[model samples]
Structures are given as C-alpha cells and as structure tokens.
Target: MSAKRICIEKDKKTSDDDKVQKVVINSLDYDSLAQIFMLLPVPERIDIEGVCVKWKEACQLSCLPKEINEIHLFFESLLDQKQTRSMRMHGSSYEASRELSAEVLYTIFCTCKNLKHLDIVHCRNDVAEIPLEKWISFQNLQYLAISCNMTPDLADTIVKYCKNLKHLRINNRHHIINTALKTLTELENLECLILLNCIKLNKESIIAISNNCKKLKRLEISIRSIYDPPSSLSDLDEISKLQYLEHLKLCIGKSLKDSTIIAIANNCKNLKSLEIAGCSAITETALVALTKLDNLQKLDVSFLHITDSFISKLKGLKELHCDFCEQLTEAGFIQLIKNNPDLKEISVLGTDSITIDLVIAADQATKHRTNGIILHIRKYDLELTQAFKSIIKSQWLVVK
Candidate 1:
C-alpha cells in the first residue's frame, strides 16, 4: 500500500507490457501457429497468411488436404507450464444479445484481409445493417454470394471494393432495379454471376452484365416469373453478347424460348450446361435448337412441354434433367437413356411414366456398365430404390 511498493509494481507491469510487445507472430513455430490457425474459421485461416511470411507458411501447412492429421500429441504433454494470450486485442467480440450477425461482417473485413470466398447467402445478418461502403475491405475476395436488400449504395460498394471478385450471386430479394444491377456489373473480373428471380431485372441489367463482365463464363438469370418482369419485356437477345459464356441457366418464364436457344447455340459455342426450367412457352423446338451446341453436356428442360420425339434425339449427354414432362412415354424415356451412352445422371423425377417398371427396365439396361448411372426417382420408390442400392445401384435422389 506504500508509494515505494506501488512504484515497484508499476515497473513490473511496464516490463510485462514490453515483453508482450516484443513477442511477434514469427516468435511461434509453424506447428504451434498452425494449431491456433486451425481453430479459426476456414476463410479467416486462409486470410491470416497475408499477415506475414511465417503465418502464410503456417497456413499452408495447416490447410494440407491430406488423409490424416500431421501432428500427434499426448494430452498431458501438450499441457505445458507456459501459457500465452493471443496478440489480437482490439477487434470484434461475441455477445448473444445482438440478433444480427453484422459483427461477423465487420470482423472479416478488418481481420480476414485475404479472404477468397464469402458465401453468406440467406445469412441471418441483413448486410444492409453494415455500412459496406465504409467497411469496404474485400481486396482478395474472389467469390461472394449474399442476400441483402440491393440498394444502389450496396451495389456500388461491391463494385468498388470487390475488385478481385470472379464469382457473384445475389438471390431471393425482389425488385432489384436495373440501375442497381448495372452498378454491380462494374466488377470486370467476374467469371460466374447469378441473379435469379429479381423481378425488376430486365433487358438493361442483362445488357449491363454482358457489356461489363466480359470475362463471365457461367450466368444464371431469372428476372421473370409466371407474370412478366416489372421492367421492360425481357430481352433474351442481349444474352448472345456474352460470347465467352460456357454455362447458362434461365428460368425466366416466357423470356426463354426457341429463338433464344437458337441464338445461344450460334453465339455461345462453348456452352456446356444449359437449364431452361419453369418456362411454359418453350416448345419441343427449343430442344432441337439446343442440339446444335456441340459442347452442350448437360440439358435441363424441366417443366417444359418436351415430348418423346425430341427427348430421344438427345445423345451423348452427361446429364439430362426432364422432370415432369408428362408427355414422355416409358419407351421414349428408355430410348433417351439408351442414346446417351455417356449419360451419368438422368433425372425423371415427376414424369408420369417413371413407374417402377420403367426404373427397373432402365436399371437393367444401364446395370452392367463400368461407370454407374444416377436415377432420380420419386420418394415413394424408396423401398425398391434401397433394394437396388447394392446391385445395379442408381444414385437416387428421392424427390417429392
């Protein structure tokens, strides 16, 4: 309690502070640092490497895609007498009272400097709560899939900060205005983009994406539902501008038709995967047009008016998803399967002719093959589906 005793204590505290300051991240060996890195979120762990050379090396060691753990330790041995606290002191903290995971965003932006992939889609935190413009720090972010109310400011923040973003997906929210979508198109390096079910996304937005993100390879757009989009009538023609497109999924109701399919076949020569689901206007002619694309490996014309004639024409397809084509006969479906020798997956989920007999017959046809075929049957087929698991196994996805 004396002044002399207090001064001695103060000197001791100052010495401890100096010791803490002297201890750098490189002071720890890779194994010890890697152990600590393993405890952080995967993105943060990957990002931590950007902190320093030692951390980067430790990160690499920690993320080895090997079969087993590199280090084996005795519990008692690991509990050494020395104990140390982490140097990171002035960052985000956890508290249950806060409903939004907005804190998670702040922590990542400030701490995880080298984050590569960020998929907070349908996240509990409304990113609108975070001032993304102010906290714009995703310098190394390559992939981002988020669901937030798409304000112009939010879109601008993404376009500005997310320079390295190669893949971008904004889903589920409505009335994503064309201007706002245009703002996001500024991400020139974008290779994969998904903007589905955005009612306000019309021709203008599509044009913007095609114009700006020239590097885009995979594009999925669904701006129209049963009714037309709120903006101008959907411009299916503008899609041809994306000459580099390799994979495209369109669920834009009537906006996707035979002409669009034909244009895609002619322009997007590299098109590999094409899905035209929930489009009522598309006739079997669309299938004929799609057959022109030599690189097309996967075709999904689910809920379309595809018949036995057109479905049989499809050959060498890796995957054929013709879910709920009520017009398709058992014989025709079998022929379709027989035609595609390389077919790995044929999903006939809701087609009326997908009977136990049809499945059994298909299994019998494809059973003796070296590479297995996956048959997606209805949930009611579970009993027989399970029975077929051991022999002539169809990788069944029992859909409702």
Candidate 2:
C-alpha cells in the first residue's frame, strides 16, 4: 500500500487521549517517523506531503536502508538494446518518474548513501548545473550518465574525487571543450565514455581523448562540424591510437569519410560492435571496408545510403540495423537472412520493402536456427500488429 493509505489506516487505531501525541506523529518528527518507518513491514513510496514527507526526510537522516543503489530517470536504451519506448516510467520504490531537481537529487544522495549507478538522461534543464559537492556523499558512485552542461567545477570535482567512476555518459552538453577534456585525462582508469549530442566535438578534443584515454574500450560520440570539426578526410586518424578499443560509434552526419572507416578497421582491429549513422559523405565502400573488421558482430548504419552489393558483401554479422536505408530492398535482406545462420536481430524500420511476406520469408529461413532471429519494424497497423505480436516486436520509430 502507499504511504498515504498507511497513514489513513493507522489513524483509525489512535486513541483520543493521544491527540497531542498524534500531532508529533502526524507532523512526522524526525526521530518518531524514522522509528515508525522501521517498524512497518513494507511501506511503499513515501513520495507525499503529509507525515510521509517526514518519513522521507527521516530516511535522509537515518540512511539505514542502503538497498537502493541504482536510479534510472528518463532513461532508455541508447541504441539496439530496447527500441520499444522513448520514455520509461522508472525510479526507486516508485514506478512513476519525478522531477530530477536539485532538491530531489539531494534527498536521494543523502538517503541512498551507497548509490552506485545513476542515469538522468532526458532530465529537465531548468535547474542550475548540479553542484558536485553533494555527489561526495555517494561513497560507491561508479556509473553516472547525465544530460547537463559541463562546467569547470563539475570537471574539477570529477578529476579530483570521482576515482571509482568507470562508465560516464554526458549528453547534449555544449561545453565539452579541450579544457574540460584535459581535466578528464586525470581519470586514467575510465573505461567507457559515451558523449551523445555533444555539439563541440572537434579535432583537438577528439585527439585529446584518443591520445590520453588509451585504456578506453567503448566510445560513442556525435561529431558536430558546425562546432568546429576538421573538413579534411584524414582528420579522424587519431581514433586509431586506442588499440584496446572494441566498440566504437561515430555520429558524424555528413563529415564521415571512407578513409576514416578504413583507418579504424586497420588500427582498431579488435572492434566488435560498430555503429555509424547519417554519414552521407562516404560511399558504399565504407560498408565494404567494415567487412575487414573480422570481429565485428553488431552494426547500425541507420539513415545511411547502401546498395544490395554492399549488403551482400557484409558477412558474419550477428546484428544489423539498417533503418531508413532506402536502397535496402526486401530481396537483399532476405538473402542476408538466409546466409548468416547465426544472425540475431535485424531492424528495417522506414524501409518500403518490408511487409508481411518478408516476415514470413525470414521466419521460414531461420526455422532451423538454434536461437530465434528477432525482426523489428514500425507499428503500422494495430490488427496486423496484433496478428504477429508474438513474431514481430512492433517498435515505433517516432516516439511520443
């Protein structure tokens, strides 16, 4: 039951002589509320304004139940994990989402002293940049993915104290300049770095990461040339410095070229998963060159131009996402489905060639497979969707 309902139920048993005593209980005195809260077997979310407000406030003071060590707010699969919904109603002890304000965050930081992983992607930007001083309370803070502007204070605090931080994702920040990156160089143990929609990704900044973060294994960053990226084809060779790099995704719209892909294939030989979308500058040769990555398993070339020849050339790929590839016809993908027996997933959203017939064809081709192949497509018809709900997981490309 909710904390509010608990209060109402507890009210019926209170004695009339305990009226003043009940005021102390109703007002939610810190010590009294904490004691009462501990007595309850399983009190639900204390997200309320009444005595439960004191219950939450008391949780901040007591810091007893450090069970909740993770918080996911406005979070979804970055790509290829779960494409069903854009927004997830997720939180701790509460399934509904709440405003990720400084006060709410402070309460969480103070309450869950051992919070290890926090993902606040798609949070409101109205609040001021989060004060990193409050973050010191998290003794076990490791994975932090947030959408906020990077400031000197934020960078300095991260460089100084956040030693255990492993996976860090900063999205839609315009201040990821060379200075901020220089501070991050202090985090030598950093393994995974994902910079989504960072408008200031440039040659110098990219070089700083490639030159310093040699231990990096996964890197996903968007290249915005309007924010000062190099125009030449060979400007991205610095990416080859990370010999340990396994998974790499570059969101360069029109600036990505074939030479850059070739360099990554030649240098980052251990690359297993590679995703490049909106790279209109390169030819189908880029897809053909990716065939050189022997370890490549997952590939996402969404919103790119590719023909039947390149699609046929790519072999041994386990997962492929070719959403909006106008030239990727039904015959081309079915051939791919029949060839790669170990193929796991294939997304053809926004492709005109996909139909019920193609779905039947793919199912028939993979009938002898050990593990089933999941097909992803747009939610075009409700009746049709209901008909194949078990076979096809209908994911809407345009999320609400």
Candidate 3:
C-alpha cells in the first residue's frame, strides 16, 4: 500500500478509539457516577464538575444523601478561592478578608439545604455575616455547634432562622451573659443545649431556658473558670422545671451538692443519663439522691467521694465511670459489679483502690454472661503478670 494511504488509515483508527472511550465513559449510570464523585475527597469532588460536560451535569444532579447531615468547616480554610490584589495586599486580618471568607461559607450554607447538623466552630466571621433575608431558612437544621465569641445578635439570628433546631452547643471561651441566652428561649423545640465555658450564664438565663424550652431532654452546662461565682443549688432550681429532661451533665466548679441532685431526682423522673464528673462537693448524700433515677443507664461520678454502697443501689446501670474515685475499694468495686449484672462498661482508671486481682475476678465472674463487659483500669508497667496482661490483650479490659 502507498505511504499516504497508511497515514490516512492511522488517523482514522485514532478517531475510532477516542469515540469508543467516550461511549464507555458515558455508559455509566447516574447513580454510579454520583457515588464515585461523592467518594472523592472534598477538593477532588469540587473539581469533578470541570472534568467534562457530562460529568459536570452529573455532579449537579447528584443530590447529597439526607444522612450526610453534618457539615464541619472547623479546621479547613474558608478562603480557598484566589484573593484579589487588594485582599492580598491587606492580608487576612482585615475585615474585608474575613467578610470574603464569610461569603464563601454563606454560599456553602445556601447550597446545603438538607443539612440537619452544622458545626462552624472557630470560623473567622460571625454567623450573622450570612444575611438571613437573602438566604433560605435552615428549616431542617436540628444540631448547630459553634465555638467562638458569641454575641446576643448571633444567638437571635440562630433562633430566628433555625426554627427546628433541637440540639445547640456553644463552647465560647469568652463570657456569654444572661441576655445572650434569653434569645435561645425562643427555640421552643430545643431538646438538647450544651454551654461550655460561658461563665456569665447566670440563674436568670437558666430560668428563661427552662420556662420557654419546655421540650429540653438533654442539658449540659460546664463552668470551667473559678473567677465566676459558683452556681448554688438555689440557682439551679430552674432546671427542675424541665420535667422531660432525661440526660443531664453538670461540670460546675465544685458547686454540685446533695440538694441539687435531690431536686433533679424529684423533678426529672425520666432521667436516664447523669454526669456529675468533677463535682468534688458531692458525697454519699448525692448518691442517695441519684438512686431515685431508676431508669438511669449511664452515670459518670468521677472524682466524687462515693462508696461501693452507692454503686450497689444502681442495679440497672449499664455504663459507669468512677475514675479518680479514691474512696472505691477493691471489694466494693467487685461487689458493685456482681450486683449490677446489667453493667456493660466500667471505668476505674484513676482509683487507688482497684487491684489486678479485682479485675481478673470480675472478668472471670462475668465471662459466663452472654454479652461481655469492658473494664477500663489504671495503666500498669511492663512488669504486669502474664495472666492479667492476657486479659487486657483479649480486648475484655482496657488499661489507661
């Protein structure tokens, strides 16, 4: 054959191969293509739209699953796009730069209408940067977790827009006064509210929340600073009004007393999970008060001065953490375990009383039971006995 003829045939073959490749790529089903795109890393997923016209169309059609509820922008840089010459010259510290970042986040929120949980912890700009009037309301937003300097305006914006918000977590290092909390009372459907390091959250705010958010089922308030006055039992009386409260975690600065626990037990009969960890003021009297919560499933009384008798009363307890409890003895611990057969996990890591023998004995006693138990014990050196080490290796025990 002639050389010119061969060259023409080679070009024809190349064109045919390209056509076959395009046909194969386009043959993939929409769902399969969407799943493939969803499996890619966030940056790659965003870039997928630019791959080809077909891929771009598929990417747009791919609605994120409803179960993909959580949106975490905490660690990631909000300013991913290229900055203008002016923004670059001024640097990110400027208000304009932060506002630009906020706009990018606002775009993200606008896109994710199906998001039930949104966590924008440590995001540069305040949530208010996203104009409520222009954007669609987050009706499905149930859980909102923000860790920043909270203003009353931000609280009002959240309560105003996120009407269905059930769980709200605020971990602000700066003081959030009572007036800021008053805005949250408007969230009538609010079931769980967690306030950590908000020192200025006073009795009035607590009362406001109790009175308005009657549907609250879980409440966690942790006051880490001693500079703020301790919340007395009388101040916590407002919590009793939340009759439906089931899970309560109070890590106040040595303010939890017998009366506080008694009030909770008397009012919140539906209590299932109770955590009073680091409440050093609590003693046997508080434990007696806790016994009233017959349905209590999880209990964390770490660093409290409670005895074995306290554990014995919680017969239905499933998970218990008694770390750093110096008062709990080996016999008492063993007796507590034997009494609470329903116990699935127990942590006694910082206790000075628990011995290797007690752990081994408990394991042996409970091994016969159908569902096994997990015991978290204090860390020991390499010199630990082979028999005890074997138990740890078996995943039945955790040493830490």
Candidate 4:
C-alpha cells in the first residue's frame, strides 16, 4: 500500500479510539453529568428522566452497601447542590473505622456548614479514628444533640467550635468537670440545654451553665445525689438571670434536702413547666412554694413523699405526675378533686394506697371535663383494692 493511504487509515483508527475514551471519562465525572441534566433540552430532558436516573444510580452505588466514606461524600455533594439546612445521623453504625468520636463529628460539621440541626443518637462511644479538636469552626450552627456514650473532651470541643449553639442535648455518663462545664458560658445564644443520665454531674456544673448561659430558656439536668444539697445557691440564683425560662427539670441525685428544692421553686417564679423527679427529700412545703407560681402549668412531683396538702395547692395545674409517691393515700385524690377543679392530666402510677373506686368517683365527679386527669394505677393491687381499674382505664386513657 502507498504511504498516503497508510497514514489516512492510521488517523481514522486514532479518531475512533479518542471518541470511545471521551464517552467513558464523561460517565465518571458526576458533576459534569449533573450539569448536563441541567442543560438538557426541555422535551428531551422530560422524556430522558436523566436527573432521576443519575440520582438513583448514585444513591444505589453509595448508600446500598453502607460505605461510610461514600455516604459522607454523597451527602456533601448533595448539600452543595441543594443547600441542605439540617442533617440527622441516627444509628448509622455502618462500620465506622474512625478512632476519635470528636473527629468524626468534626468532619461532618465541617462538611455541612449550613447544618442548623444535628442529631447523633445512640452512636458508638468509642473514639473515631480521627479526633474532633482539629476541626476549625462551625459558625452557622444552632442546634446539636449528642446522645449515648461520649467523652467529656468531645463536649468541650463542641462548645469551643460551635459557639452560636442554641439547643444542646448531651446524654453522656462520663465525668464532666468545671472547665468543661464553663465552656457553655461562651454560647450566648443557647436556649435549651438537656443533660440526661450524666452520672458525674454535680452542683458546680449546673451553676456554671446557669451563670454563663444567661439567655437560656429551658434546662434539664441530673445530678449525682439528691440529698447532697449544693452549698452554693449560685445555680439557683442564676435562674433569675433567665427571665424567660419556661421549662426547668432538675432530677436531683440522692443528696438534695427539702430546702434545696424550696429554694429553687422560690427563685424561678416564672417557670411554666417543672419536673422534680428523684428528689426524695422534698415534701408538701416545697409544693406550697411551687403553687406561688400561678403560671405553673405542668408539675411532676413524682417519687417524693407528698401528701394531701401538696395536692390541694396545685388547683390550676394541668399536667401532674405523682408516680412512685407511695406515701400518698385516698385523701390526696379527694383533695385534688375538691380543690384543683382545673386539674387535667395526672399520673398516679406508683400510689398503691389509692383504690380504683376512689379514682373512678373522683373522675365521675369531675365529669371527665376539660383539664383531664389520668390516674395510672399500679400493676398489682391488694385484696381490698377497688375493682374500678377497668372503669378508670375505659374513662380516661382509652376513651378520652
């Protein structure tokens, strides 16, 4: 064959190979493919369903096998495309090989800057492969809830990075010290703070949070012992700073005394909802002081040895919980009906002394009207117990 013919044939072969390579490369550049969908002709795009097919293919490849990094990258890309406002990572126990818990959180926070609400519920307590402290800042953050096992250091790191945090729920059993507690002071916008089942929390920690977060509106805390009354009323006094407080839950440890609780109620007069669970030392006197807050809508004096006097003071109360109050008798229920005519929702689950007959009579007398009352009877009743259990359930929890 002649030299010119041979050259022309070689050029045609190379041109065909180039076209094949271009098609293969285009399939891999996902961003370009996404742009192509945006630029498609109206009629052709409608028939093609190009965007839907691409997303389905991407999601199947990324989320199907449960690859952590792939899922993370996919979410990041989606965030960039859609400008995601919130994200929740719940029970994503898809084999995270990370070492530091804080590190994994930091990476997520960094990638998702527009994230306003973040929920990491029931995650592994073990440290991720990476530490969280290295991450810079998350300026636009507002709400954060980290539940289950977590280190105190990670909590501190969060306080440092997420300064504008408004709502925080940390349910960790680790020991939280003063330094870590003080970190909350930096969060000026913090509105709601919940620390559930944190065994190591003490009075000092509460005091620090209250003192620092002056704009706080709601706070839920659990201490080491209810009886061990905090020598410093700093935390109690801090309530006055939060003039807008609406909900306050103090699950005192075994060390608190009657006075400690009274002091709290007396100070936070504007409180709308108060739950004093596990505060065994508190009595009727504290309840009387609580009634002073005429605005009190919901009160849970459960597990405390309260009597009829306490029940009478809460006349306008809405939701009342008296669970585990073994000392309460029929007199309390009778007084409740006679006095608190507005009493609506009530839970008297652990009060074994009150019979179902007495409860039914009270409910009937009340006419099951507005401000409904629910008498959650115990599982077992004595031989002399009233047979009104069936009636009570039918009237309140079931029908109403």
Instruction: Judging by lDDT against the true structure, name the best candidate.
Output: 3
Candidate 1 structure quality by residue, lDDT tens digits, 276-309: 8887777777568777777889988888888888
Provide the lDDT at 57 for model 3. Answer: 43
1-400 in candidate 2: lDDT tens per residue?
9999988878865655488786766776565665655554332323322234444555433323546667766433343322211112224322113334444555555666677777666656422255667666665778877776676567777777677778888875455655676677567778898987755655667777888888889998775663453464365778888888989998877767788887888888889899887777768876687888888888888888897777777777888888889888878877887776667677666777666666667657655555644444443545555765456332311111
Candidate 4 lDDT over residue span 37-136, tens digit each: 4464434433443345443232222221222221221233334322221122234422222111343344454454555555553444432233574434
**Candidate 2 whole-model C-alpha lDDT, 0 to 1:** 0.66
Query: Would you list the C-alpha lDDT of every candidate in the order shown?
Result: 0.67, 0.66, 0.69, 0.58
Please report how far candidate 1 places residue 319 from its true position, in Å.
1.5
Q: How displaced is residue 216 in candidate 4, in Å?
A: 1.6
Which TM-score value belongs to model 1?
0.68
Cα lDDT of candidate 4 equals 0.58
User: Which RMSD values do the candidates have, in order?
Assistant: 10.8, 8.4, 10.2, 10.0
Candidate 1: pairs in clash? none
lDDT of predicted model 1? 0.67
Better of 1 and 2 by TM-score: 2
Q: Ten residues in a row with the worst lDDT in model 4?
A: 64-73
Candidate 3 TM-score over all chains jointly: 0.72
- In each prediction, how many residue pairs overlap at the backbone (N, C-alpha, C within less than 3 A)? 0, 0, 0, 26
Maximum-TM-score candidate: 2
| TM of each candidate vs. truth | 0.68, 0.74, 0.72, 0.65
The 10 consecutive residues of candidate 2 with the worst lDDT sum are 81-90
Please list the residue runs of candidate 3 whose C-alpha ends up more than 4 Å from where it truly belongs after superposition.
1-69, 74-103, 122-125, 132-136, 225-233, 372-387, 390-400
